[model samples]
Target chain A: EDQVTQSPEALRLQEGESSSLNCSYTVSGLRGLFWYRQDPGKGPEFLFTLYSAGEEKEKERLKATLTKKESFLHITAPKPEDSATYLCAVQPGQGAQKLVFGQGTRLTINP
Target chain B: GAGVSQTPSNKVTEKGKYVELRCDPISGHTALYWYRQSLGQGPEFLIYFQGTGAADDSGLPNDRFFAVRPEGSVSTLKIQRTERGDSAVYLCASRMNSNTGELFFGEGSRLTVL
Candidate 1:
């Protein structure tokens, strides 16, 4: 079975604090790794997609990096507006469009 | 529409009743997906459609859960004999292409089975 595990189920950070969320996975063959940010009462917003080890993508204060067995979403100088649940999902090569998601890490940035 | 849209933002029904949730994908998007999310958990894939055909429905929990996308642009998820365990947020997403790996999601429909 393809499984994804995210650590630090919940994290509280001061405004401008930096931290990284972890997503570890075990799959037959990883086709893609995805990161998303979801606010309360709203759908998840797409953040980044990492397809290969050593790949990294960034947008604004967020940076996502991938390794052979895990991925990290680094939040730099986060603000209160960045507080949200960060989700991680993995798609196996065999499963065309299926995504196995982690429980997610709820991040709170207190100003 | 500019983004994926789902109807019936919130629905509350008695157990054993039937319910239908709808999703409208973005214009020109050929791949549509359905997922269910519980509190404090990530979205779980339920089905996937490419055009008018269901390419994958393996994630569906059981036969009581059925989804259709006849016209390819709009889709409906029907749940028979709704149970309290079925209460969750049903999310719909779309991608311009299957290989893109990036999916745009709708606001989601919250279902409460009483």
Candidate 2:
């Protein structure tokens, strides 16, 4: 079965402290991997979508990279406004329409 | 609205009662999806609709759960005999393309059954 696991269920970092959150996944046939940011009392906001191994995408202070077995979300010099739950989801197989998501990493940036 | 919209931002109902959640997608979106998110868990797919037809509903838990997207724009999720286990944030998302398109989500409706 396809599954996604995110590491460091919760993390606390000071402002300007760079760190990375990991998402390990097991899927029969990988199609796409997605990253989202969710704040309290709101729905998730889309971030990046990686389609193949060695693919990388960046937005502002966030950078995402993908490999065969895992993906990493690197946050550089994050501010207090960047604190949110980071989620990783994977779409498996060619004909699949659903995305299997990880539990997410709760990131706290102390300002 | 510029984004997907959900109604009844919060609902508190008794066990065994029925509940309905509504979603309005962005104009001209052909694909709509429903998901449930429990505490500390990722959102789980419940159903998907394409142009007023249910394309996939394998993620729905049981017979108590049903969803419909009539007129290909508005969708509603119906839950019968609600239980405490049904308490969660019901999310609605819409996308322009049926395949390989990113989904835009709404704020979601929080349902609490007691």
Report the CA-based lDDT of candidate 2 relative to the real structure.
0.94
Per-residue CA lDDT of model 2 for A1-111, tens digit only, reads 899999989999999999999999999898899999999989999999999999999999999999999999999999999999999999898688888889999999998
Question: Candidate 2's residue-wise lDDT over B32-60, tens digit each?
Answer: 99999998888999999989999999999
Task: Encode model 1's per-residue lDDT on B1-114: one tens digit a residue.
Answer: 799999999999999999999999999999999999999999999999999999999989999999999998999999999999999999999998776668899999999999
lDDT of 1 by residue, A40-106 (tens): 9999999999999999999999999999999999999999999999999998887567778999999
Q: Model 2 - which docking category?
A: high
Q: Mark the 10 consecutive residues where model 2 chain A has the least summed lDDT.
A: A91-100
- Candidate 1, position B18, lDDT: 97
Which 10-residue window of candidate 1 chain B scores lowest in summed lDDT? B95-104
For all the candidates, what are their Cα RMSDs to the real structure? Answer: 0.9, 0.8
How well does candidate 1 reproduce the true complex, by DockQ?
0.81
